[model samples]
Target: MKDNLVDNNAYTYYHTVWQNGDVAPGTHYLDVTANDKFEGIVKVYVTRRYDADNDHVKAFAIAGANDGSEFEKVADVELPNAVKAGKAEAEFTIAEGKSYSKLRFTVTSTTLERGYWHMAEFQLRPMTLNADCKNATYPEAFAAITKALEEANKAVGSVSVEDIAALQNAYDEYKKAINPETGIDAIGVETLRNNAVYDLQGRRVQNIGKGVYIVDGKKIVR
Candidate 1:
C-alpha cells in the first residue's frame, strides 16, 4: 500500500494500524519534490472509517520552499464537514504566480485515537491557460480536451493510459488547428499534409518526437 501511494496508483491505499504505535498527537510532515519553481494545485486523497469517532484529520497545512530548508506557508486547507466511512478527496489551489520547488504537507492534528494517518494518493498539477482554451482557434476541440483532462485529474482511483492518450489526441488536434506563431486560426496551413511540425513553444521542428508538438496549427505526436 505504501508503494501504491507513491506509484501514482490511487486505487490502493495505506492505513495506520492501532498496534503500530506510530500514531501520536503531533505534527507529521510529507516532503514532495517539485524539481523546480512551479505554481499549481495540490490534491490529497484520504479515507476515514466512521467506525471510530476520532478517525478524521483535524487540521492540514501546506508549505513550500525553494532550497528545501526555509519554508513558507502556502495554504491552510479546511477539513471536511462530515466524516464518512470511505475514502474522499480534497483540492488545495495554490495562488497564481507563486513559485516553489519543494512542497510539504503538515498534518497538524488527527481524530484517530492512535494519531495514525490514512491516505490513498497525492497529486500536484501545474496551472495552465489551456483550461479556458484561450488563444485556441478550435475552441470546440480544445474544450473537449480540457474536459477530458479535468475528468482525469478528478479521478479517485487508478487511471488508465488509454484515457490519458485520448485526452492527448484531442489536445494535439486543437494545437494543430491553432497556429502557434499567430495564436490564431490555421486556415492557410495544411497541417495533416505538412510533415513539418513545431513544439508547444512555437519552435519549428523536423520531427514530431515523443512530447507534445504543433503541426500546422494542430498538436500531434510522432
Candidate 2:
C-alpha cells in the first residue's frame, strides 16, 4: 500500500514543435487530495517524438512526492529509436494519493538545423484507485479576483451612479431568472465604469486628454 496517488482521469497533454517552436521543455504542478483508500502505483506516460537529423538526445522522466515537497526521482528512461527514427517514450511509477508537484521532462537534440532539439509532447499520468473529485476552495479560486478588486478600489473609491444603475438592471434580470446562465455579478465591472461619465454620443465626458487615465485597473486615452 502507498500513501500518495495520481489521478489521470480528466485530461491529457499533447504537443508538436515545428520550425516556429523548435524546442520546448517545462514543468507542471497539479493539486489533488487522497481518497480514503490511498494505495496505488503513480504512473506517468509520455508520448513524444524528435523531428531532426543526427539528433542524439531523447528521454523522459517522472518524479513523485507525498506532500508536494521533498520530491524523489522514481522513473527515468531513454528513447533509443527517437535519435534515429524520431520516436520514443516510456512509463514509470511513483507512490500515490498525497500530492506530487514537480513532474517534468527534458529533450535535447539537434534536428532541422536549428541547433536545438524539436519535440512533440511529453505527458504524465498518475494511477489511482478511483473516486477522486477534489476541487479548489472558494477563497482559493477567488483570490485573483479579490486582489484585482482591491487594486481597483485603491485607484478609484466607490461605485458610480451609472454603475449602480447597471448593477440594478443586472440584479433585476437575475431575480427574474431571465437567462439564468448569462449574468455575471456586476459588482466589479459596473463599479469601475460607473465612475467614468460618458456623453450620449458615447464619448468620455471626462477631459482625460493625452496623459494616462487609469480606470478600474485599466488605462484609457482621450
Candidate 3:
C-alpha cells in the first residue's frame, strides 16, 4: 500500500513480473475501494509496461460491486501490446452507469510465454451528470443554468459567481409565480351550458381552440 499503483505518480508499477521464460503465465487482479458510492467510471488509463523483456497483460476486464460482493463485469478491452517502448501511456474508456463502491480490474497475461503484468499508473475517474430539464415545468429557469454552464466551460479560468447567482435568482422568482397549487385542469368539450359553452375569457366559444374554460362549476378543455 505504500507504493500504490493507482497513486497517479507513475514512479512505480504493480511489479508482478518476477518470473522468467520458464515460469508459468499469470492473471493479475487489482481493485480500488471508494469511500462513497459512484455511479460509473470514465477515462480508464494505464501506463504501458516500460521494458520489452517482461511478459505483460494484453487485455483487461473491469468489474464492480456495491456491497463488496457479487461483482458484475462492466467493461473489458484488449490492448495493442503488453509492453511498448515508444510511449508510457495507454487510454481506454468505460461507460457503465451502475452504482458501486468497489472497482476491480482483471488483467490476463499474454499467451505462449512467461506470465507477468506491469503498468505505471492505473487511473479511473467518476463523474456526476447534470439533471435533465427538457420536460420540466419551468424550463426557462433550467435553461438559464445551462447557459451559465456553457459560459463557464468556455472560459476555464474566469468563473463569474454573479452570473450563477443571477440565474438562481431568476429560477427562484419563477418558482414564486407558479405557486398556490389549485390542482384543477380544464378538459372536455369547448363549452357545456346546455348546448352553450363559454371560455375562461367569458366569451361565447363554439370551436375547439385548446383553451381552458368553465363548464358546470368546473374547468374543461376541448
Clashes of each: 11, 6, 4
Q: Candidate 1: which stretches are off by over 4 Å?
A: 8-11, 15-22, 40-58, 79-87, 93-97, 111-116, 128-143, 149-222
Regions of candidate 3 where Cα sits further than 4 Å from its true position:
1-11, 21-26, 82-97, 109-115, 127-222
Looking at candidate 3, the ten consecutive residues that score lowest on lDDT are: 180-189
Candidate 2, residues 1-222, lDDT tens digits: the string is 011111111122233343554444332223234333223455333222323333333454444555536656655655445432222444454544344544433443223223233333333333343443211222332333334433433334355555434434443443344232322323224534666633211234344322224355244332
lDDT, ranked from best to worst: 1, 3, 2
Residue-level lDDT of model 1, residues 95-114, one tens digit each, is 77777788877666665533
| Candidate 3 accuracy as TM-score | 0.44
Report lDDT per candidate.
0.56, 0.36, 0.50
My TM-score estimates for the predictions, one after another, are: 0.50, 0.30, 0.44
Worst 10 residues of 2 by lDDT: 1-10
- Candidate 2 stretches with Cα past 4 Å from truth are 1-51, 54-61, 65-68, 83-87, 96-99, 106-118, 132-222
- Candidate 2 residue-wise lDDT at 207: 43
